[model samples]
Target: MMNTYSFPLSTLGLPNLMIQTSDGKRPVNISEIVFLESARNYTFAYLTDGSRVITSKTIGIFESPFAKHGFIRINKSIIANLSYITESCKNEGYAIRLLNGQWHTCSRRRTSKVKKVIKQLKTL
Candidate 1:
């Protein structure tokens, strides 16, 4: 459904990249790299083509300025790319529609802040 490119790491000495299949066993090749915070010892890398959702735990507290161009910190646990946002609404709470058509909510703790940012984004 989505275009993917894969490169082998055997030659370059970089870690190999693979796509997860529906069966959860077959790892296919895909193109594109995304950085995510690791739940354990270190940060990890992943493919952007449906490989995973970026979560807050995977991101470091000190964020890169470059990430500001496309990503927004929604709360303590989530940071999402504006490009992947399909729609968003806020009233008493905040809800966002992602590119995959999935809806995610901004926790009440972060709702006001989220709305403020969304408002700013609309003007830009």
Candidate 2:
């Protein structure tokens, strides 16, 4: 059996990630971020409200920092918020559907890791 605990997302010590914009910087809640896509020289954080922030940080920087915040690298170019992964389908292929009605294919190399994380989340 898995050990279950009552831990909120904030208790994980995940910070309110800030992003730079042409105007200024904006504090973003983790829950608001749907995923992040790596750009040429910057990365774009896509929000639940259909907004995005382009920053100079690389995708690698985000991987270590936001790992405990329910964010996972589903692919080389994508970092998805695991908390919002509402459902998964493996009939045709492995993919996860988000609460926002978006579906992303889990990379072949990361499919098992993603599934393990999901199982751990259930026992949390």
lDDT of each: 0.47, 0.77
Clashing residue pairs in candidate 1 are 5-30, 5-31, 6-30, 37-58
Put down candidate 1 lDDT per residue, 41-79, tens digits, no spaces.
Answer: 333334456565332333554245425444555655455
Off by over 4 Å in 1: 1-48, 53-57, 61-67
lDDT of 1 at 73: 57
Candidate 2 lDDT by residue in tens digits, 1-124: 1122232344354568778877788898777887888986689988889878888888888897778777899888889887667777776557777656777888899999988888787777
Q: List the lowest-lDDT window of 10 residues for candidate 1.
A: 1-10
User: Model 2 clash pairs?
Assistant: none
lDDT of 1: 0.47
In candidate 1, position 79 carries an lDDT of 54
What is candidate 2's CA lDDT for residue 93? 56
The whole-model C-alpha lDDT of candidate 2 against the native structure comes to 0.77
